[model samples]
Target: MTGPHPPRPGAGTPAGRPPVDGNAAAGLLGEVLAVEVTTAVAECRGCGAHAPLAQAVVEVDAAGALVRCRGCTRTLLTVLHVPGGVRLEVGCLAALTGAAPTGGAPGAGG
Candidate 1:
């Protein structure tokens, strides 16, 4: 679960026009991002300490992408990103964010 990202004030308020509620805490668009979690980032889910599980990798696609902790299997969000903006679906944060999956992998265009 994540906290609600409130929309900015006056985002849809226009002069001499009715304020649009579409930007009210939802229905907003922004740039995407990507992330690759190496196996060395294991941490304690209870104490947030790292010191367990040798190696495990997870690819995230957004600024706040969540993944299963290697030690406790708890959901952990990542803020890492690729060279360019993230372009993965926010729904499946655990999996790599990309256009689509081809041949059981990402970017393998068919």
Candidate 2:
């Protein structure tokens, strides 16, 4: 018997374009977290789903980037590049867990 079919390229995309992965947010997330963020675990506020930030669905363009939960299509984060610096919107993330940049507790002087 055949298994369930997978989603099409544009299955849940509003613009009918395939969504990118969270790796697309590397630069933005790196600046915000001061560390590699792809390995960080992000908890989605909408569906309470947890996954590495690298696994989140992402959409990027000239304006900036948007990260969403793969399970519920709920936006989890947004990053905007402005003249001064990058602006990060993360109200949709309930929590995030990861190793500190220096491999120590966050805020602990190395």
Candidate 3:
């Protein structure tokens, strides 16, 4: 018989803890962005390492999410949900690419 399952990778941590993968960040980003952000490419400013956004380390909470580079543990992106709009901080990415609109906007030509 299977024993109790092990704790999830980033779960069961102390308070103020964040998940350890970009999946959480992607979910939070989905609330604001219309594109599939996780599949995008991100170049870390600190180490100049390039990888998919999905590979970044992400810490998520009710207020916002923090994304960091896997290579050097440097902060890459931050997303905050605030009144009226979301605040995004992207100080860690030297380059990012591949984003498409989610579509279905009003007052747009078909």
lDDT for predicted candidate 1 compared with the true structure? 0.39
TM-score against native, each model: 0.23, 0.64, 0.58
- lDDT of predicted model 2: 0.81
lDDT of 2 by residue, 1-110 (tens): 99978887658557565557888656555655775689988998899999999999999999899999988989899999999899989868998888667665433111
Clashes of 2: 0
- Descending-TM-score candidate ranking: 2, 3, 1
Model 2, residue pairs in steric clash: none
lDDT (CA) for every model shown?
0.39, 0.81, 0.77
Candidates ranked, most accurate by lDDT first: 2, 3, 1
Clashes of each: 4, 0, 0
Error (Å) of candidate 3 at residue 51 is 0.6
Q: Give the lowest summed-lDDT range of ten residues in model 3.
A: 101-110
Better of 2 and 3 by lDDT: 2
Candidate 3 Cα deviation (angstroms), residue 55: 0.6
Best by TM-score: 2
